[model samples]
Target: MAKALGIGGVFFRARDTAALAAWYEQHLGVPGFWLQEAGLTIFAPFPADTDYFPANRQWMINFRVDDLATLITQLQAADIPVETRPDEWDTPETGRFARITDPEGNPIELWEPPAA
Candidate 1:
């Protein structure tokens, strides 16, 4: 049987779609039609009561990054708050993880998988 290849796109509602799209491109470098590099894409479903992310939000988007520290610095310089729990989130097996919210309050996960 044929199976789904990969995620084609992510759609969500925003108060100002244009501004939000621009913010993503400006800050995270994600454009409307992004060409992502091939890598591991995690598809896990969390319990309804899980507190991993904001309860109000139904889903969270995770993006793989080349360098987490540099990206975090760039985001911080732009006055965007980034949350990192290195002790709790980072590991040799998994990798480093950081969390940030969009201007419209959407959770975005920045993951730098362990180097091969």
Candidate 2:
């Protein structure tokens, strides 16, 4: 039997590809063709018209982060945008979360899982 262990890459269309790539690198510290931490890979395909995220956008990209507070502050200082609704999403078991949009209007969810 064949089985897949993890996501290899995430390739998507962008309006200004180079600027978008730079946005991820400058604000999110994620270079394109990334090999993320701890072999942590996510594979989930959102529906074409999914409202699980904001309705204005067609797709969302979720990334896992280590320290939410520090990252949020750094992004703010750098003039990178961040949107947080902790009361709407946070729970005792799920830890903290925030949201942001890339330069191309693709949403990126920042998730920090609860510590053991």
Top of the candidates by TM-score: 1
Q: For residues 3-62, could you state the per-residue lDDT of candidate 1 as single tens digits?
A: 999999999999999999999999889999988999999999999999999999999999
Please report, in order, the local distance difference test score of every candidate based on alpha carbons. Answer: 0.97, 0.81
* Candidate 1 RMSD computed on C-alpha atoms after optimal superposition onto the true structure: 0.6
Name the lDDT value of residue 36 in candidate 2. 74
Q: Against the true structure, whose lDDT is highest? A: 1
- What C-alpha lDDT does candidate 1 achieve relative to the native structure? 0.97
Judged by whole-model lDDT over C-alpha atoms, candidate 2 comes out at: 0.81
Separate clash counts for every candidate: 0, 0
Among all windows of 10 consecutive residues in model 1, the one with the lowest summed lDDT is: 27-36
Residue 100, model 2, lDDT: 78
Misplaced by over 4 Å in model 2 are: 39-42, 45-49
Measured over all alpha carbons after superposition, the RMSD of each candidate to the real structure, in angstroms, is 0.6, 2.1
